[model samples]
Target: MESTMQLLNKALSVQRAAAWVEDMNLSKSAISMAQKRGRLSPVLAGNLAIKLGENPEHWIAVAALEAEPESELLTRLRKAANSWRKL
Candidate 1:
């Protein structure tokens, strides 16, 4: 499980965090908790994937099978999303 702070750090864009908040049905605080010892559901994962420019359905499928998240998975997701944006 990722800490809220970690997720927040990983969120390269406020748009990413805002999108997560909206889709997860979570308040910023709740997202914070989720980041700290909380699991990101397939829906949430799909939302992030969508934000990253991947097909939501494609990630949703991956989310279904890959319920548990680790550093490796999260890293892959993060890279796939490429949260970084040049201003």
Candidate 2:
């Protein structure tokens, strides 16, 4: 699964990402933190996915999975997210 930083890098430059965060009324530091941590909060992920014309649910699931430690549930949810992405 692609990290939020990966998705952002694919769709926008660092400057553009920061500008987008600002446009969303969020601090530019949000983008910086996601880049540094290689993750995003589910809400931010959903919003970013929408801005990039991707499925928000898929990203929301992915972000949720990433926020937690590995486990059977995470694996199952990852599979479900991948399946949802195919739709």
Best by TM-score: 2
TM-score of model 2 vs. true structure: 0.75
Minimal lDDT window, size 10, model 2: 6-15
> How well is each residue in 30-87 modelled by candidate 1, as lDDT tens digits?
5555466444556665566666665556555454534554668766765664432111
Backbone clash count for every predicted candidate, in the order shown: 4, 0
- lDDT, model 2: 0.77
Query: Residue 1 error for model 1, in Å?
Result: 17
TM-score for each of the candidates: 0.40, 0.75
Write one digit per residue (lDDT tens) for candidate 2, span 37-61: 8888899888878887888887887
TM-score of 1: 0.40
